[model samples]
Structure formats: C-alpha cells, structure tokens
Target: MVQQMVQGSVDKMKAELVAYIDKKFEIAALTSDSSGASNTEETEDSDPITLSMIMLQIAAIFEKFGHYDEIYRTYGIEADAFQDECNEVLDLMRYQVEQVESQLKDFQNRLHIEESGGESAVRHNAEMQEKFEILSKDVQESISQFDQYIDTQLKQFEDMPQLLERLQQELASKQGKSESLVRLQEHKSEMIAKIKAAVEELNLQLPKVVSAQIEKALKD
Candidate 1:
C-alpha cells in the first residue's frame, strides 16, 4: 500500500515537472533580450529567476518522490529515490504482517483448547466435590452405627467379666459344703469362653468395617 502511494506521488510530480518545463521553455522563447535595450536588464535579472524556479521545481520533485537515501548517493541531493525505498520497506512489512497473522491464528487455536480444558476441569471438580460430600455423609452414618454397636457390645462384655468373677468367687467360698461347686465352676468356664468368642467376633468385624470405610473414602 505504501509503495502504491509513493508511486502515485511520483507520477503526479512527473506530470507537474513536465508542465513547469514546458512553461519555462515557452516564456524563454517569447520574452527574450533580442532588442538590446532591455537585453542587459533581462539577462541580469530574468535568467537567474528562471534558473532558481527550475532548481526549486526539481527539488520539489525529489521531495515528492521520497527516495532520500539513493538521491543522496547518486546526485548528492534527494531525488526520486523515495519511491524505491518505500517499495522495499513496504514489501518487508507485508511479509512480517503475514507471519504475525499466522502466529496469531495458532495462538487462537491454543486459546480455544485451553478454554475447553478449563471448562472440563470445572465440571470434573464439581463432580468430585459432590461425590466427596455424599461419601462423607455415608461414612459418618456408618461410623455412628459402628460406634453404637461397639458401645452396646462393650457393656455386655463388661457385665460378663463381672459375672464370671462373682461365680468364681462363689464356687471358691462354698467349695467343701457344696458338691455342686465343681459343676458351677465348669459352667462359669464355659460362659467365659462364650464371652471371649463373642468379643473375637466383634474384633474381626470392626476391622472389616474400618477397612470398608477406608476404601469408601478412597473412592470418593
């Protein structure tokens, strides 16, 4: 675009320069110092003025052309070098713009992927939070039930130990007077074994329940 604008200005300057040259030629041909009376005065003043005008026109043409660099190198004065420099710079700029546009397009595609990934992450986080909340509630409920069962079983086991102690004491105190003491001692031992079995059952179940809770927590 800059090249085109520079070319257009050069063409316009060329046209104007041609017109100025024609006008100068015509004026010189018509109004000359031919009679010798005005000749000295015209030579002294008019020729210089015409030369100055031509020089000014040439300078203006160079300025319009905008090739200052080459003009300085070739003629030691700025001339039509402006157009050539502008064309070179503009071509380079066009290539840079194309590269930038391609990079911008690639960035846009990456931005879309990042946005989509962000959205997916949001959804996944929400789902995980929901699952965590549900699992936490279930775990809490299960733990409460387990605690209640443990409390009840503990109370029962405590009572059994006290009963065993009392029965042992009774059998020892009535050892000689009561023949039934032996049978009572045997019954007490059986009762103790049954209590131990019940305690073992609860111990085995408690660990399983805790492990299940841990697995559930992991899933969530």
Candidate 2:
C-alpha cells in the first residue's frame, strides 16, 4: 500500500514539474520522449530547485515511509509483549477460578454422600443466610478456643446441618471471588484488543500521511 501511495504521489508531482518545465522553458530538460518518461540529471540551470535536489526530495519521501515502518514494527512487538503478559496473568486467574469451582463440586459431592441425622434434631432452615452466619461465627470461635475445645467440640459438631451451612457459605464466597476474576480477565482482554486495533489503525494511516507529506514537499 505504501509503495502504491508513494509511486502515485511521485508520478503526479513529476508530471506537474515536467509540464511546468515545458511551459516555462519551452524545452524538455527533464524529459526527452513524448511519453514524458526520462531520467533527469543534475545541471547548473537556473530554476526554483535543482534536478538533483528533486531526486533528493524523492529519496527523503521514501525515508519518511521507512521511518514510520520501523516505528510500526516496534509497536507491533511491544503490543505482543503486553498481550503475552496479560495472558500469563489471566492464565493464573483462570487456574484459581477452576480450583474454586472444583472445591465447590467437592463440597456438593460431600453433601450428597454424607447423610445427615434426622431433621427433628435441628430445625434451622438451610435456605436462610442468617442461619449460616450464626454457624460460621460459632466455627470461628471454636478454632480460637481450640485448646478449650472439649466444651465446644460437641457444640460445633452436634448438628450436621451446621456443616452443610458452612459448606454452602464457603461455596458462595468462592463463587463470588471467581466471578470477579472472570470479569477482570474479560476487561483485560478487551483493553488489549482495543490497543491492537489502535495500532492497526495507525498502520493504515501512516502511508496516506506520508504520501501527503511527499506531495507537499514535491510541490514546494
């Protein structure tokens, strides 16, 4: 694309310069054939700019395109490095989410396999959050007083429903954390995509801008 744009700018500007030469000098110093196709050489002729300077100007135009191309390649490398880093972090987060999901599955299996005692022993509804909160606090206190836990040991395990309640609460907490991680990973990926898209847009625009600059230089 850059090649086409540069060639188009050079051809148009060269034609205009040739026409100006033919009109002002009434002679073709820049072209020898009717096709207006010939190589121009340096001469001490009086004009706005020398023929060699025109060739230098064209070389400079090509240099501009090369300069942008180098920067574009660097941008691509930097963007790739950033994406790789984000993927590494995302992989770790995915593993952690998977671990939580696995634990939740284990809790579910344990709940199904371990038969609870008669419902008549404890009448707390497992659906209520308050019941689980009470059980969780009791468990924390039991751990704090582990040395004095003969008194609290029977209290902690007296009801099988308390274990189920604690398991459900833990599962809920893990799921919430995993959901946050999933959202963060998605946002990271979206930002990376946007960055890559911006780089591509810059790549697309560089040639056009360079061509415009080349046209302006040739005109001057």
Candidate 3:
C-alpha cells in the first residue's frame, strides 16, 4: 500500500514535469517564429532609424535567447537531480522487495515445520501463505510500474540534451544572420552617403566646365 502511494505521487510529479517542459518548448517555438517574422519584415528596406530599431530588436532577441539558455541549463540540472532521486527510490524499493522475499522464504520454512505439528498450525500457515502471495503480487506489480516509469524518464533525459543543443544552434545561427544584416545595412548607408557626395561634387564642377567651353567656342 505504501509503495502504491509512492508510485502515485511519482506519477503525478512526472506528469507535471513533462507538462512544464512541453510548455517551455512551445513558448520557445513561438518566440523564435515571432523573432523570425520581425526580422523578415524589418530587413526589406531599412533606413538608419529602421536599422537602429532592428539592432535593438536583435539585442532584445539575444537577451531572450540568453534567458532561455539559462532556463535550459537549469532544467538540465534539475532533471539530473530528479533522475538521481528516482534511481535512489528504485534502489530502495528493490532492497525492500528483496527483504520481503527473504521474509517470505522464512515464513514458508516455518510453515513446513508447523505442517508436521497439527491442524491449527496448518490452517494458520495456509492463511499466511495466501497473504504472502498477495503481498508478493503487489510488489511485483509495483516493480513493473516502476520499471516502466524509469524507462520513460530515461528516454526523456536522453532526448532533452539534444533538444537543448538544437535550440542553441538555431539561436546562434539567427544571431549570426542578424549581425550580418546589420553590417550589410551599415555598408549600404555608407555607400549611399559616398554616392551623394560624389554627385554633389560633379554638380559643383559642371557649370565651370560648361562656361569655359562656351568662351572657347566664342574665341574660335
């Protein structure tokens, strides 16, 4: 009965933890999509002011990624601790089961001794045997359930690091792209300013060349 209760509590905790992790992944996906959309919309035709805004947005996205990364790291640590706890529980339960089996064997040995004694001893021994069988079945079921839970938890633990690593890679790629976009925008602005200055210089020299050409034509 105690083992059943403990299993129930562990199952509940597992459900809650899985739900929380799923929600975190969902939020991260949504945030990434939103960031991508914002970048797409901003990168089309950015002026200096717009570029500044993009830079700010990129900074904010980086900050958010950093926060998410920390959360992931914290989650990993918590998961490791939780795994350790589950392992300890499993080990304890296994020990208890072994002890129970030893007690069952001793009881059976006593029952065999009592079998040669009398009818009353035989009746008590039969009752005890039934109770022991029920107890053993319950213990077996609990161990089976525990094994399943451990398998599920192990799979989750195995997948988690991969998921975190993928997210980190994606964020890094986005950051690089954002930085490249900023550099390209800056280069574009510089080119525009240089072209404007060159045009102004040509405009300033055009009249002088035209007036000199007219005077030369008149002399001819």
Candidate 4:
C-alpha cells in the first residue's frame, strides 16, 4: 500500500510537470503569434513583458522540479540515480533563466538603438541576429543536457526531438526576418539575395547541428 501510494504521488508529480511544460510552450506560441501580428508595423520592439512572463514560467518549472526531486527522494526510488540528472537539469534551467534575462536586457538596448534613429535600424537588426545566435547556442546546449537525462530516465519521452526541431525552426525564422529587415537598408539587390541565401543556408544547417547534438547526447 505504501509503495502504491508513493507511485501514485510520483505519477501525479510527473503529470504536473508535463502540464507545466505544455503550458510554457503554449505561452511561447502565443507570444510568437502576437509578435507576428504586431511586427507588421516594423517600428514596434519585441515585448519585454512576454519575455518576462516566459522567464517567470521557467523559474516556476525549476522550483517545481526541485520540489519533485525532494519528493522522489522521500519515496526512496532511484533517488541516487536521479541526483546528477536533477542537478544538471536545475543548472540548465538556471542558465536558461540567465539567457532570458540577457535577452530582455538586449531588447531594451535595441529599443534605445531604435530611438537613436537613422541607419541604427540596420545596426539594430544585425545586433538582433547576433543575439538570436547566442540564444540559439544556449538553448542547444540546454537541450543536449536534457536529452541525455531523458534518455537515461524516461526513454518514452519522444517529444523532445520534435520540440527541439520546433525551437530551431522558430529561431531560424527570427534570424531570417532580421536579415530581411537589414537587407531593406541596402540599395544593391544582388547583395540582398546573397545575404538571404547565406542566412538560409545557416538556418538549414542549424537543425542538423541541433539534431546531431541530441543524437550524440542520447548515445552517450
């Protein structure tokens, strides 16, 4: 009876974690959709409030996972095996929080750049692409860590690969949009085509890179 109760609690916690993650993704999709609607103006900056909300949700996930870890320990079920995995996941979550905070700060800086006027728009777009690249790298690293952990702990969670692919696609779309915006400042049509092609190639390569990393993680 005690074992059954413990198992029930564990299942409940897992369900809650899954629900929370789903909600996080939902919020992210909503944010992207809202941004797409507003981005038609070309003058509006990315919403800091939306980013802050995502960060807050991430923090909550971290905290909830910590609590779940403690509960797992109390149940005395593979707690030792999970210790390193839990620690690594928490570290990744903390790193992601830092990344989100950095993004928020960068967005504010971009706003200031916008206010400065003139060719700053082109410069701003370039900086935005650079920021996205950094963020993409950070996300790839986090996903790699989690992919490894998932392999060892929950092999049934096949959605991770799809999730990673979706994230990479979103990042690529943002990069492409930024590049196009920057190209608007250039008078040479040839240069714009070349730049767009280069960025598109990079975007095509990025998913493969992320996929390779996840595959390597699973193997290790």
Candidate 5:
C-alpha cells in the first residue's frame, strides 16, 4: 500500500511538472513570436502557437495521463483524487477567464464615462455647477447600486465548492467591475433607447442646480 501511495504521488507530481513546463514554454514562445512579428510584415502563415494553444496541449496531456490506468493502479491513486484535482484545475482556469473579462469590462466602462463627458464646454457657471452636482449624485448612486450587486453575487456564489478567494481579488482589481454599470454598458444600445424614450422623466427627476463660476469661465 505504501509503495502504491508513493507511486501515485510520483504520477501526480510528474503530470503537474509537465503542465508547468508547458506553460513556461508557451509564455516564452508567445512573447518571442509577438516581439518578432511587431518588427516585420508578419505573414498569417507564420503565426505561432499562443498561450491558448499551450493550454490546449496541457489539457491534452492531462487527458492522456488520466487514461493511463496502469500508472494510477500502480500508485494506488483513487479515482476521487483524480476527479478532485481536475475539477480544481478547471475551476482555476475559469476564474482566470472571469478575471480577464472583468478587466475588459472595466476598461469599457471608463471609456464610456469619458466619452459621455466630451469636449463641449458649458457657457454658464451656474449651469455648470448644477450639472456637476447632478452628475456627482448620479455617479454616487451608481456606485452604491454596484456595491449592493457585488455583495449579492458574493453571497450567491460563496457556497460554491470550487470558488477560490484569490480569484475574487483578481476580479476586484479589474478595471470596470461595477455590476449595474457593466450591465448597462453591455446593453448600451438598449439602454440608450430607453433613455431616449424617458428623457423627460430624467429631466423632471434631477435637481436644477447651476454652477455660475464654471459657466462664466467657459464663456470667457
């Protein structure tokens, strides 16, 4: 039994080592290929195997190792252990993807906000002050709503067996993670259509404060 246990450990270690090596190789290859391509015409035919390809190869290797029953049997590795390890790895990969997507969404949100406040100048200080107040209030409300949404998501997904805390940190550091804002960004055209339909509702609801200082400066 001891010998079998030792063998199982060795098999698991071997599989993990191969996976790590593959990852490093892929990173190096991708970096080199991208750098080289940036300096040249870079024909499509000359494309290199990217990080994604490396991940595919890693998956294939794991699959092959999984089918090697003799090694598992020799090492006394239980089927449950194999399943647990695979599930953990899969969950980790999914978390990584989620993090990247979150970051992308954040970048989009910031871009959207900046675009919304373009180069047009407010001519009246009073009007500018009022607009600023309204915008600040709206932004704060959006933030509060997003915080509530994240709390809810955390509560809902917390009990998931495969959830990792590190993944949450990565997602948190992402660029535009405000749930409500991100959702609106995703459905922008639809949201814009809705806004157009309810412009009067918005105008009526928001306060009518003005910034004379800002308006006067713009006029000058």
Candidate 6:
C-alpha cells in the first residue's frame, strides 16, 4: 500500500486529508425531489439559484476526493451518510409544506361559515397571521442555513481544484477510484431528487400563504 503512494509522501498527505475532512465535516448531499422550475424569486432571503442546483452540487464535491472508502473511515462520508443528509433537509421542507397545506385546508373549511368581513373571519385571519409569522421565521432560518451550505459547497469545490486534481491523479494511478467516484455521483443524484418536489410546492405556496400582513391586508 505504501508503494502505491506517490513518491513524495503518504503520512503527510494522510494528515492533510484528515485535517481537511475534519475542517469540512462532510460535503453533505442536500436532497430534494423533482421540482418544476419553482419560482424561488419571491423571497428576498432565498437563494436565486434553483434547489436542484444546490442538491446536485455534491457531484462537484465527490470529484475532490481520491479514496472513497478511506474518506468514509476518516470522515463520515459515504452513500448512506449522504442519503441521511439528503433526508434531513427533506424533513425541513416537508415540515413547511405540511404546515402550508394544513393552513390552506383550514381556510377552505371555514370559507362558507365565516362572513367575509365578519368577526369569525377576522379572528381566523388573525390566527393564520400568527401561525404564518412563526412559520415564516422558521423557514427564513432554514433558508439562511441552506444559503450557508451553498456558500460552503461553492468554496470547497472551487477553492483548490488544482491541488485536488493533483492528489486524485496521483492516487488514481494505483487506486483506480474513478469508478468509485462515478458510483458516488449517481447515488447523490438519486437521493437528492426525492425532496425537490415538496420544496417546489412549499416555494409556490409560501408567498400567498403569508400575503396578509396583520393590518395592511387583513381588512380584506
């Protein structure tokens, strides 16, 4: 195994890799199922880029590492871990999606009973206002975290491509990790697509869900 290492070193490179993974945590796969070009432009806080872009960025990260198994032991990055990360993000989207769906359902249920300008409607509007304000705040925080994630990925994939290439090139000569890299890329894509559809629904509903701003639009 030592003979397989490049001429200059093994221990130093291993240490460097260990340090890098420690610092990076992992280039996690943030999953989302299929979405139909959801309008992400409505929110000032949401990233302009599509969620699909964010989910697919894992491909760029996989290209950085040479030994897939070694990286897994050294860092908790593998197909299963990547899927778990994807599911975790999906959970967040599901939460907001469910919330909006419930709110909309309740709004419909009360539509005929409550007079358009009556006290019951006013109270229901106030109730929805409060619920959505809380939901909006939580979603904003999630969006911020995702934006940070995107920035993190952008930095990692772009930061040191040359050095990364040198490492992969040298290591691939003996390890033939190119095949492993391809498998990981396919795994990421499969898992990440599962959550995009829910996120798209959430994105489509959120603005209209929160259209009433307590006083300004509540009168209607």
Query: Highest TM-score among the candidates is held by which one?
Result: 1
Please, what is the TM-score per model? 0.36, 0.26, 0.25, 0.20, 0.22, 0.24
Tell me which residue pairs clash in candidate 1: 66-82, 67-81, 67-82
Ranking by TM-score: 1, 2, 3, 6, 5, 4
The Cα local distance difference test for each model comes to: 0.74, 0.59, 0.62, 0.63, 0.60, 0.55
Model 4 off-target regions past 4 Å?
1-77, 118-220
How far out, in Å, is residue 33 in model 3?
30
Model 5: per-residue lDDT, tens digit, 87-189?
9999999999999999999999998886676554334556688877876665566556555654654464454333334345545666766864555445556
Q: Worst 10-residue stretch by lDDT in candidate 5?
A: 205-214
TM-score, candidate 2, is: 0.26
Candidate order by lDDT, decreasing, is 1, 4, 3, 5, 2, 6
User: Which pairs of residues clash in candidate 3, taking residues 3 or more apart in a chain or in different chains?
Assistant: none
Provide the lDDT at 63 for model 3. 64
Model 3 — which ten-residue stretch has the worst lDDT? 42-51
> What is the per-residue lDDT of model 6 for residues 27-105, given as tens digits with 9 covering 90 to 100?
2211122233433322322433444654454444344334543554555445568779899999999999999999999
User: What are the runs in model 1 whose C-alpha is more than 4 Å off?
Assistant: 1-115, 177-188, 203-220
Per-residue lDDT for 1-220 in model 1, tens only? 4445566778888888888788667656645736676656655655533778878888888765757434445653333576678889999999999999999999999999989799888999998999888878877877887888888777766676677678777767774746657768687788778778878978898778877887877765
TM-score of 5: 0.22
Q: Please tell me which predicted candidate would have the highest lDDT against the true structure.
A: 1
Clashes of 2: 0
lDDT of 3 by residue, 1-220 (tens): 3334445655665565566556656654554566667756544433323346446655655665555556666676777788899999999999999999999999999988877687987788898888667666655655565556546544544654565566556556775887756655665576567557656755565555555544544444
